[model samples]
Target: MQNRPDLAVGRVRHQLKFRLAQVKRVQPLTPHLVRVTLSGDDLHDFESASFDDHIKVFFPQPGADKPAMPSAGPNGPVFADDQPRPIARDFTPRRYNREAGELDIEFALHEAGPAATWAAQAQVGQYLGIGGPRGSFTIPTGFDWHLLIGDETALPAIARRLEELPPGTRVATLIEVEDPSARIDFATQTDLYAEWRYRSESDFPGGALLLALREMYLPTGEGYVWAAGEATIMRAVRQHLCTERGVDKTRIRAASYWKRGVEAVHESIDD
Candidate 1:
């Protein structure tokens, strides 16, 4: 009899650097999602090893032609006190093509934020600054199946994971969007079972997603669960999975991409 391979998660650190890039193209993937492609010589060596890896995008201050770039400091990045600081937001590197010197980032237009506003009107030749992914958490694909859960903000990462999975891999996804218009197709070689939940007037962020997860059927055998969305909901998800579903804590990864009434929130739920 053959033995199943052991599943292990790995982490890799990256050198931090900021690069300047220009908007090469902008396309609307769905009603609430806009994809902006940036190109630059600096992206030649850019690395995004994990599907959920994030890059800090810097936006120009109001009425400014370009963003104020930051310099490396002992503690972290240092901004000039004399100059207006640029607005920065965290976004997943949806796609990156090294030879073509291009990187794709998708923005969720559900809310009014600096990044979303910039992406909504992003035009070719417009310049934007991007910083490091800093690190990557590599999850082994040798598990029996994978469960992915998230909302519109986590779409890019979920889509990237679906695309990267090996053939015959089993993955079940639960995605929450604004409405039917926000739904889109995913291209993958894996055995995919995707379910979409639409939000209503009374629903809170991740409300529909959590309801679906509670009733969804999990695949048999050892599997990994990856989820990201609102902060409060993610914490509940981790608890339910560990307590109700009896899933091992180490076999699950949950992240809070955003929080209610909070700006620039991105964190992992590991408690």
Candidate 2:
């Protein structure tokens, strides 16, 4: 089976060109999910280190009527030198096509974030700004096994990781979504031990991911783990893996992709 059905193998390692582009909204994945497909000349050169790498997306000011992008300063692009800068949010690159020079960014449309709001009502020809992927991250395809876990917020990155692994690679993936319909098909020839969990509550606070991990006894092997979602949940999972399960800190790439009760731009999780 192919490594990534969406991206060509050679394009996987190429540096992606960075530039501002217009946003196009595809059919909403769910009541709260919007898939935004962005295209621009600059995308021809956008670089990504791995499927999990993210780019910074800039949205217009609160009252702006048109899709005005940030200005390129003498040193580089400048975002509102005075007062406050426009909204900037991080989004994973779900797919990039060097040939078409387009990118697919899936946005979760929540009530209060700039990127989310823009995505929900984005119109054709509406321009938005973007920044470097800078680099991408992936473990060499040499490990004996792999473990991936995260919530809906982490699904894009997790699916991308699954696609990038070589055929026959052993992988275990656990994903938590709001409902069963939110579950998307991830086709791969890799030996994927996949599971999905449903959270009945609407955005309630709980370390469901950590709970899932703690209940399972994983296959004993030298493997790497990647997880992302709520910062608090990631912290608990990372602590458990590194300290209790004897997984090396170096082998885990865990991050708080988002935090509960915080705005996207101001969200932070301890390193």
Candidate 3:
């Protein structure tokens, strides 16, 4: 493990730095999960304190050798008219070490797009640009228990939260993935009950994640729930937690990472 940044000293930082990172190593964690480690000199001042903090990754065009990065101005990023806009995708910061100037970003190899394509062919020494988280949703530690539910896209965030949690903290995690081989070991000391649900290729279009949540016995007491993944499926899970399980709306944080068959989409609970 590397030294963490002083990011969480107080509240979340609205002002952040954007840096160009070079790919140091890429390891295939599972059949559908790849862990990419990036390091750069400019990343020394980076800050990401929240569990679900996002970093925008810029990808080069199909035939281009490098991505055109947007310059930062007083307000925000400044783009040039002559240069082609780089394709960008939002991803969670799985791990970061200020001492080493390295950040681990996990990619779920479930979709096909510029980001996916880039991850599939990512090589050492390749550069990828990253930007601010803008803000973070830091969960309070006072909850009796924690419930983390999502698909592969939410795994990085889930793992971050699990590792950050204090020892003896109780947690129940529901993860829907391609198969059992897609499972990842939790390195945290928290009392975690992890459930990995597999989806059959022949199965009809349905919400397997929601079904798994409905069948499980939710832990008792005041708990905080974080759910992310397919939009409609997440909607159903949020509804179930509130209407059926009597979970408080304010205690649950839900976000739609993407929609089935929809291109480049994300919707948060507040959206």
Candidate 4:
């Protein structure tokens, strides 16, 4: 298992040294999905913590020049003195290849956020600045079972988790999406029970996922529950997991991938 590195403690220090990366390739994976591969000389030092850890992307406007990516601390990368920096957005690192000095990020082109718009039109050789591996969180695979819940924005992280899991591991996944055709397959050799919750065009977040979760049957055992989606929806899931299902606080992870009526946000849970 690649010796798992001295990850627990040294991970934070490694993250603090956020190096600036440059965009290298961009392609559409699906009609609503864009895959962007970034690379830079600084990537030689990029250390990955886990699948779900995220980085910030600084995107340039159509007419404007590229923006300077923010540094981890007060003194980091300096922007060009002449051009004003473009808007930046937070996104998850879908894949990282330090040997090849490349990192891949997938974006869902649903909304017109700065990040989404940039990704939809991204091209090879175009330069965008990147910073941070931030931090990582993972539930111990030794658990009796695991539950994964999320929407499209959370798919990359969820997919990463499924891929990294061990064989014979038991997991339950409930993914909510606008269409059933958006479903992506997972090949976890584990005892996995996955369900897809489709939210029709007439429906919105927190509607179908909540009802499906409420009506679904959960196996009885000690399990870790991880969920990410719209802020309010995830909060509801968290509340149910803690109060209704009687799961321990530490065993459950709920994050808001995006909020309704908001734009260009990446942080899970605002308040």
Ranking by lDDT: 1, 3, 4, 2
Full-model lDDT, candidate 1:
0.88
Worst 10 residues of 4 by lDDT: 1-10
Give each model's clash number.
0, 7, 0, 0
Worst 10 residues of 1 by lDDT: 1-10
Worst 10 residues of 2 by lDDT: 1-10
lDDT by residue for model 2 over 106-189, one digit each (tens)?
776666767777788877777777776755655666567789988777777777788888899999997777778778778677
Question: Scored by CA lDDT, what does every candidate get?
Answer: 0.88, 0.72, 0.82, 0.73
Q: Mind sharing the TM-score for model 2?
A: 0.83
Model 1 vs truth, CA RMSD? 2.2
Q: Write the per-residue lDDT of candidate 4 for residues 1-271, one digit (tens) a residue.
A: 1223232112343445545556788777657667788898877777667665777677766675655554455555455567666576767788888789898888877866777777777877777766676566645666667899998888888887887788888888988887876777775688889889878833666688888888877777667778887878898888877788777676677787788888655554322
Positional deviation of residue 115's Cα in model 3 after best superposition, in angstroms: 0.8
Clashing pairs in 3: none
- Is candidate 2 or 4 superior in TM-score? 4
TM-score of each: 0.95, 0.83, 0.91, 0.85
1-271 per-residue lDDT for model 1 (tens digits): 1234458788898888888899999999987999999998989999999997999999988887677888766666888999777799999999999889999999998557898889888899988899888889999888889999888888999999999999989999988888889987998999999999888732576677788888989877889999998899889889989999888888899999998788899889987
Top candidate (lDDT): 1
Relative to the true structure, candidate 1 reaches a TM of 0.95
